[model samples]
Target chain A: MSEFEALDFYLMDELLSDEQRLIRDTVRQFVTEKCLPIIEEHQAAGTFPTDLIGPVAELGMLGANLPEEYGCAGLESSTYGIMMQELERGDSGLRSFVSVQGALCMYPIFEFGSEEQRREWLPRMASGEVIGCFGLTEPDAGSDPGAMRTTAVKDGDDWIINGVKMWITNGTMAKIAIIWAQTDDGIRGFVVPTDLPGFQAIEVKGKYSLRASDTAELVLEDVCVPGDALLPKSGGLRSPLMCLNQARYGIAWGGIGAAQACFDEALRYAKARITFGKPVAQTQLVQELLTEIASEITKAQTLCWRLGELKDAGRARPEQISMAKRNNIEMARNTARRCREILGGNGILDEYQAFRHMVNLESVYTYEGTHQIHTLIVGNALTGLPAFG
Target chain B: MRIAVCMKAVVDSQARIELDGDGNLRQDQLRFEVNEYDLYAVEEAIRLAESDEGHVTVISAGTADAVQGLRKGLAMGAADAIHVDCDPDDLDASGVAAVLAAALHDGGYDLVLAGVESDDLGGSQVGVLLAEALGYASTTLVVGTNEPVDGAMQVRRELEGGEHANVQVQFPAVLTIQSGINEPRYPSLKGIMAAKRKDLAVKGLADLGFDGAPARRVESLGLTIPPPRELARMLEGGAEETAAELVRILREEEKAL
Candidate 1:
């Protein structure tokens, strides 16, 4: 197998520290040697490779950007972004597991939970001894989570949560779910243990995309927990939105990984696959496709790296993240499609990664705030007007 | 105990090596990595250090690029690194050994480890020469090492034709390691972070009390790709006829039945 060389047309490596480069190279090697070998089989069977959790955690990838006080790696944001890029290069499914565990689940607890809550969950989750999922989207509230009907009613010292969550990544496999519900004050976050009496997580079946990931629907029929389960600092929809921003930031970098994977596979196939009288790589049209994809990947990489720097500096804006999430995912989707075309009939085969990445990009394009939602966010930022009604 | 691992940076064997018009390697295009056998040596040093509460210091002789290999060794749990700032191409085996011996001479290390041979040169002379320079007893083709018993280290040496011998050497000895001693672990993230904080001392030939000139130099004569082997012949006929032809070739043409 040809090694996946990350496109660094902008010399982005010059901006990274030695530690960051080491982390990136280590994770890239891990993904190339470990994840890529079994990803296809898992995707074919539509099963998540649970055996990888230990190895992934051993790399300190779970909550890697978080502080080391709670057993995390405490790496810089750019290093975290590079790790996401490498993981997604192997498979979007693998990256999704990390994104859900780190950005959506662990991050919220670290950012908004009480000291006791943080002390209880962060270390175990970081070690992959316990898996977690974020539950915000509902059956009727896909794009507009404010319309979620999940309710948390006070029953003495306990809050009884009642509702259903949809399209939850890692829902079926998680040991805990960070559920967002409407309380008397506003929407609040609650940590609901999956083993609770009234909580149920059923695996969603027949997903054509992101086949190697575990997506599920969570049902809470009066799931009761002590008042301590509520994230004391979380109030209103902004809390979940903050978590989505973290995940979306990772998605921006991850989109480039998928694009790089497709581009690398297509480039290899073009040189080896012969048509007519010569290799297809010699054809002008094929070369144009390669050039365009390479150009877009470089641009996307620059955007993600700059955003990572801004994030590390605590100067990044959510709208800027929206722009990157929107632009990079679109670029990756388009690149995957073009790379698929470049591979011709062989593109549809599972042996080639372009088709698999092309399909996975569809889910990545839609999740963590859809492409349309992100476009509106950027549009609202650019023009001083609210476009969403 | 303190262990010193002598490492070398060599071009990746799988990389495409190109020769320039002057018959010199196109070094700019080739990807250089830590010598494969040398990695086993480094791993063994780290293992020995970890179990004995000792320290491992990796030393490499090359230009600034050789620091990459040293950093990799550090990331794999070495305590520290020393970069001998000299272009590897400017020295022969003895000259390289001289530089290494100089760096190791005053370090007060109990043991010195090196690969049996580097992947690029395949010259199995450096360890023996380094032993001669440092006045230390030496063993080559070492497959394993036992804990020190009675101030002496017991090492298993792989002999020719699948044979092995156990030899014991006193402290301050040089051992050249063969590959497959153990599976080298990838650098963990914590180890990588720790490596960033560890000291990487850069030393020059003058610091080692030697002039920049080498005692011996190696000059390449030429380079060529080995000739491809002949393709196998295919016999075409009925199964019985093909089988008969095969038997005839093995019995008559080969003079064996």
Candidate 2:
């Protein structure tokens, strides 16, 4: 593959600090040199690239935006978003792993866990000696996590969790799982060690979307954890929703990456592949598709940059994040389809990235609050009314 | 074993090459990175310093943009950095050598390392010239080095056509490193963060007491891209006819009969 030409139509690079640009470039190099080579093979084999975890951790990608005191990079929100963009440029599955690790798993611990929990886990997790997964979505609770059937019952200063979590990313290999369950008080998060008795993570197999990632059905049959394992500050569905906000912000940026990857593949193919004695890129129809994709990508980049700035300022609302996630993922989905169309017959092949991203964006479109869920969230914010039944 | 590594900032390999009407590079349009060869020199220095428990300092002579390259060195675990504040356009290779020598003269470095050549210029003269200016023993195309023993270090050099030579250079020496001496590591996030806190002292020519404008003993005669080569002709014939044609051309066109 040719080197990724960063699509900075608005010259967004000028807005980034030197450190932020360096971080983004470092991750970009890692993607080009490490991830792109093996990702297709892994996706074909339906296996995760486990070897990259060590390198990714050494780069401090996990929990990158957290505080340096707990062994993180302490980067700004925008830098973290940039990291996601570059990582997803390689593959959405790869970005999903980091998002699950940083935003879903490690973030809750830092935000709501006890200080001892943060001290014990964050450093090891930062170094990649330990891996983590988040378990919130269930067979029944896809969008409304408040309706989750998982229960955490009090038993002699230990919580006995009994339930199943579906679509858990990084589940099988995680050393620990951050499980959000319904308690007597409300929906709460628990830091459950995967090695504990009655805890099992069965790999969800034969997945077409996100094939390079490890998804699993995590079952907790009366799993017991100490009282300290509870995330002290977490309460109600809002806590888990906050975690989703973090991951969604990353996905908002990640959508652009997937779109850009497909766009790059299609552009290269259009310029090189000859039809009717002329390059397809020279044709008006092909040019139109390329232009539309580029324009959408530029708009998405602008949106994400402003969103990141707002997040760093602590002024970004959940509905605003919903707008970004919804708009960018839908934009990416449309771009991927058009790019795939531009590739014509070759679009179906895994050798080309268009179809691969086309399928992957489908999963991205649904997960982390589906397109419909976000639309309502934003709609509600605008109308001052609850439309979600 | 306090070591100093000399770095050079060159145009990034991926940046589009645009020459001015005068046949010089459009400097403002280019993005500069640490010279590829200099990474090997920096890596070797860091490795030696790590094993021998010494400090490594990186120094470079270029414009303000050169600090970005120096920061890369620091991120690769160099103990500190020294930036010789001067426009590279103002200096030839000799002037660069003089600036580096002036910076390192008072630092009392036990060894100095530099790349065999800059990626853009490919002059391969800076290290040797710096050695001469500082009155230190020097070796070029050094591929490997052993630990210092009895005030000298064993070094391996690559000669022409895969031949190798081993020599022992005394302390306070300069070694121009070749590529493949070692695989340079990506700067870890921890290293990148720590580099920000590392000491980076920028010195000017006046501060180094070389107050006069540098004399360019060898000046550049501009640069131009070589003309594109003609495409090769394809043979349009059966295997037997093509083979016969190739032999005929070899005998007649080349006069090789």
Candidate 3:
């Protein structure tokens, strides 16, 4: 029951008001029932649970932490983590779907969009009527997005955008993309309609990790955007990094959920499957592995709880997210391996699900910011040195 | 229409539980969670409210400790909640059922649902007894449901092993939901915040008009941990040898290959 382990550390329950527990439990239930069943199948099909959009919206998951009105769910940062943890408990790909759509895409528009623009798009996005995607990483410029070749030029009352984005989640199906491109004003975001005359998206196939997630390559050529489509207040590399920061925080909690699921599966398998005439649970090594994995999960939970508090309090900086992103995700990857060991041969199969989880952990390890990228971010924060070349 | 759901505050059943000295459950050492199976009931109630013209209320028959579990239900869109507020030592499922029945009567809910059993206890009797106490037709393991007419209702019940049976019963009937009836919705942040002030209905024994009545006796409950396995048993062998040993063990020793 590593997955179901009611985590209470450092009197965390007392720290959370009654409302926090309620929210966490509600998300927990939704993850267990809704996401867990169909997640594997969707991954196999290389498609998304499009039907889930309405349900997710109804649960107020989309733009959930945004303010009330405009049909927003109006939760706080930690509450968003609650959603991520539960969603990723089913599959990291599914959680990534929400994080990209909500945190990476809608958030920038909400933060920097013109009032008229907000009034137009926020409600529709909130209602799941129009799905959104963020375009930041490009084929040529990935970790260093400041070097992006994608460009937008000003024309009277509009911006002509031309570029390609790689590894875009929800790209193929999204009706909107909050794309970042170099303008004369430097890197700026535009809430471009994907159906624009020259915009194209095709699903990215052949991924061993996050297979359940729909990632696509976005090609925008001479895509014209009205003045209203641009996020006017945002400028500089800071714009997209801010979005990445939000997504990373959610990933911090989400990675732990995946680890917990694997730990739970392994722990159960070890106890029930007898080896050499006795239950494997009785073995010290098996117990040791289980113990280590669960402890890692608990530690990750405690770290995320603190991170959530820091984020909700508005004291969280990029390095705080980077530290957690680096540590928790690697912790998840390690825990998945340990759990995979516990299941032995059954671990390799999809139904038992440890191997897929292990595989998915690899994608999680690389996305948003790779482990090395987060490490450099933290290193730079500590020494006041920029490590990324 | 008004609906009520009975729930338990169980340690996440998937959580690893350890016992303390002198035979009491060391919940302090264990990871705490809302009972897993009960969540299906909470989700169903939420869906029902969303679909119909009804209000859903949740009630649990435990003390301050049970508050978290009730809040979890409330956050899943239950309109209100109540806690019987009793000690954890109270053992009788019937006693728990009695408190729930009292809450049901007081709340005036037209329909009630419960998970067929607590994941920890798997006691599939509480809903049945509560239904009897309230004088309503009760069914367990409902897998599907239909709209309730003014006074009558219909539900699809899951029978033994992949089979299903549908039945209609009158108002005030109790139907226990089976797992996977519907994917339970997570509590929206709005639901979570709203659940905060929704009245826990905390009451003492006198308020429910009962003082420790029992349907069954507790005859010593304890957990036993099997002896640890010896370290020498784990063999370090190559794949072929491992497979041969596994097959031999599975066939000759355990009598199943």
Candidate 2 per-residue lDDT over residues B70-112, each given as its tens digit? 8888988899999999988888888999999999998889899
Cα DockQ of the candidate 3 complex: 0.44
Q: Candidate 1: where are CA atoms >4 Å away?
A: B13-15, B160-164, B221-257
lDDT of 2 by residue, A271-369 (tens): 999999999999999999898889999999999999999999999999999999999999999998998899898889888887778888889999999
Question: What number of backbone clashes does candidate 2 have, counting pairs of residues 3 or more apart or in separate chains?
Answer: 0
- Per-residue error (Å), model 1, residue B198: 1.1
The TM-score, computed over Cα atoms with residue i paired to residue i, of candidate 1 is 0.93
Tens digits of per-residue lDDT for model 3, A76-141? 888788778877878888888889878998799888898888888988998889889999999988
> Which structure among the candidates has the greatest TM-score?
2
Model 1 over residues A69-144: C-alpha lDDT tens digits? 8888887787888889889999999999999999999999999999999999999999999999999999999889
Task: Note the residue pairs that clash in candidate 1.
Answer: none
Q: Report lDDT per candidate.
A: 0.90, 0.91, 0.82
Interface RMSD of 1: 1.8
Question: TM-score of the second chain in each model?
Answer: 0.90, 0.92, 0.84
Model 3, residue A294: C-alpha shift (Å): 4.9
| Candidate 2, superposed: residue stretches over 4 Å from native | B237-257
For residues B8-38, could you state the per-residue lDDT of candidate 1 as single tens digits? Answer: 9888776788888777788777867788888
